[model samples]
Target chain A: MSTFRADLHIHSCLSPCGELSASPRAIARSARERGLHLIALTDHNSARNAPAFAAACRSEGLAAVFGIEITTREEVHALTLFPTVKTALEAGDEAYERLESEPFDPGFFGDQVWVDENEEIEGMLDKLCILCATDLSLDDLGPWCRSRGGILIPAHIDRPAFGVLGQLGFLPEGPFEAVECTEPLSEDLTDPWPVIASSDAHRPEDIGCRCLEFEAPEADFEALVMALESGKTRALYGNK
Target chain B: MTIKELQTDMNCRAVWNGWEDREVTGAYTSDLLSDVMARSEEGQVLITIQAHKNTVAVAVLKDLSGIITASNRPVPDDMIETARDEEIPVFVTDNNQYETGWRLHELGGF
Candidate 1:
């Protein structure tokens, strides 16, 4: 088989942690220019920008995964990749509803813009997206995402903050067959799930910088999910 | 008024080469990124003393015309890099928060 480059963790401007130039169009263009085969627009706790990002990716001929980097109540982060954009939105609605009631003050944080496929300013959400965490604890978070047909990849497992290893003291036993890290090939893990590395890029240009080269029959969502689920550790190549 | 006019009118300096001809339709002042996200409209100039990398993040999310680091807080290079990468203008002033607020109010003609 052949390996394709994939960075399944990207944040659009929908993420307050992501830069504004991180518009869906800009991200797709940059990813295409950088020779990435596929990417995921995994905003922080919200999939508000995925529809637009998916459309933008379509124009660039890049496969975009509709996903979110969800932070559980315990502060552990998981990258939830959905098989379809609608599924992600459905799960996001439920996740948003579960977030603690914390009103946003536009005078302090700034606006949350939702752009359209044409890069038009569609609307804005007043919620402070990055601060709210889902009510699910670490254990609940995994199954919750899976119930929605999402592939749960614990994000940045090597980091001291927001990482499964650091926050939960250990990676919980779950349906996860693969894991995502900020860097490549971390040997410190007590249990090795086949690792996939991503840039975790909040900025547009950083997309695809720390991606994984994996054997996939095709570059679409199904092929990606199957390849990752198989988690052939020997076939994974990460550019740390 | 354009960001250049806003800077010259308010006596500010370009901290990074983030100057753009984008017009400042209005102004917003805040310390928290979430507050800015929840309230501030697009194309407004954001005023804050919180100088860190995330400042640029808010600027991008909100489509801010520019950022002003009031109270003379030092803007870090990484934050400036984000601004530059995002093409958002960042200006700095030696005045404290109140003085900066008053000047923006005077210029805003409100």
Candidate 2:
């Protein structure tokens, strides 16, 4: 049978938009309920929760991929997925420096809260937890992700925000292995790239509701990346 | 017109007063929660019609300059109260999502 059940993009409470229910344990429990085999907690710019999230996923017999959704200098968005939590953390450090900037008090956004697997409320994050880095460019991000044994996918190419097309009007010369889409597209599109669709879920209800099905030896980050890079995947949206 | 002028011209009320001086760097328009979370930048403003609380969460995670709810849609009371608490700017526009985004892009010079 094809390895079909996985969600490559999800956010924890660490992300400003993530639901309070988006704790690592909460996500894991929800994934289990939804029958997802793999899930990634890719908070915006910060992977501070990855270690804890990964640990929780393991306890639940769910495979977890540590990742961060980084905003490049050009304002394009990319998903950097790592094989190990250590690599994801190290990449977070690099992202912190590259994406870090003075906290903007839009006077409408509240302070970000970090939570553990137990769904317990943790302390507030200082230094603007959301603003992780401003230094990493699209070119630099690719090598960092690769060196750390991670895969980088340009996020939501069809959308008008932070998309490679929306920001730069075209894909950068190199550094991206695939493009993520929120909706389906024709395979013959001229982008000359493979496409992956994810829910990019921020709420538990959203997890595994949409995913990519691929033929692989195993259901792990490495196998998923290889399938995506080789263009051997199909978008699958859960009917439930 | 600059964002400053547009804000005034459109009677755009600044929810977060501190953001007035920051130049309107650019605008990002989206409704899908995950797409916005994965892509938005620190200072860019987000324009969408989705008025759920999760919209605020995504906006905060991305460190968005502000959020504009389009099509003259009313910002939910709970979301407004939350936005007030978070210090993130939230507003409603008479134009639909596409038109509001286009107008913001034209005015912001994007």
Candidate 3:
């Protein structure tokens, strides 16, 4: 069995709040240098950066997953992962349609830029208001994303704002594979589903600082998803 | 008072003239989205200077009568689009929040 060092929640420059230096090339190089076995590119609300991110990961010989951190209409945040970049991007497009009716204003809340592997601007996603929650609810999110073949996990359950339990006061017990915590686990916290921790890093230094470790035959997307769903590897919350 | 009546009297300009017949029985004023979301009631006129797109979201979520960009402050271009799309009347006026509140008090029961 191989022990995989995985940081499955990370943002690229596509996120308006993300550091400009968190480009696809810079992330991949940093992941390799930090000895991360797997890194997932999870930009907020849109996965348009997956193509460039996956390409950079391949060049570095590091495993990568395509994912998005979506904020539902009720202001709850969730992380959705897809096995393929094509599927992830398509799902992102669908989610963008349901986002809050306001469009992104670079002058107001800053830029929501789409960049390539070399960190060149392709275009800006003007239709999406990246800062506020999208116009989707937890009930609407499960049926829509699962039909497109993606796994949803309530993100940062410890926080008071967008965390599922913090916002809704109870987990919906939907098609979620797990719940992610950015803070340390508390025996006081209880949920029917498993909990995992990630850096949810917006900067290169925070990447792999907190991650999930597991033993699998191979550290591929399929294996990681199975491991999470089957409850094989719970979490390895290493404080780096 | 109705949105059309208020706008006509205030000499407010329409950025996107939504259901003007919508009644204004109450009014809310705040810069924070969550504050508006939590405190504002339906059919109330929201009198904030906040000119972002999320302002439109809060208006819809809270079922406001209309949005007035106070002091003739420019609302974001997309915000007007959302107000129009949601059929929520959006207006702009030279009056600040104090003047608007005083006007609403004269109208009474707001």
Best by TM-score: 3
Q: Residues A1-240, candidate 3, lDDT per residue (tens digit)?
A: 788878889988788767878888888888888888888888888899999998999999988888889878767788888888999999887777666544434543356777876789897787544435566788888777778788778888777546776677777757677788876666446355667778888888888878888678888888887787676665667757
Error of 3 at A164 (Å): 1.0
Q: Docking quality tier of candidate 1?
A: incorrect
User: Where is model 2 more than 4 Å wrong at Cα?
Assistant: A104-107, A121-123, A127-133, A186-190, A237-240, B1-110
Of the two candidates 2 and 3, the one with more favorable TM-score, higher being better, is 3
Q: Considering only the true interface residues, what is the Cα RMSD of candidate 3 after superposition?
A: 8.2
Docking class of 2: incorrect
Per-candidate DockQ versus the true complex?
Answer: 0.05, 0.09, 0.05
Better candidate number, 1 or 2, judged by lDDT:
1
Q: Rank the candidates by TM-score, best first.
A: 3, 2, 1
Task: Indicate whether candidate 2 or candidate 3 has the larger DockQ.
Answer: 2
Q: Which ten residues in a row have the lowest lDDT in candidate 1 chain A?
A: A231-240
Determine which window of 10 residues in candidate 2 chain A has minimal summed lDDT.
A124-133
Clashing pairs in 3: A73-A136
Q: What DockQ does candidate 1 have relative to the true complex?
A: 0.05
The global Cα lDDT (0 to 1) of model 2 is 0.73
What's the TM-score of candidate 2 when only chain A is evaluated?
0.89
Q: What share of the true interface contacts does candidate 2 keep?
A: 0.00
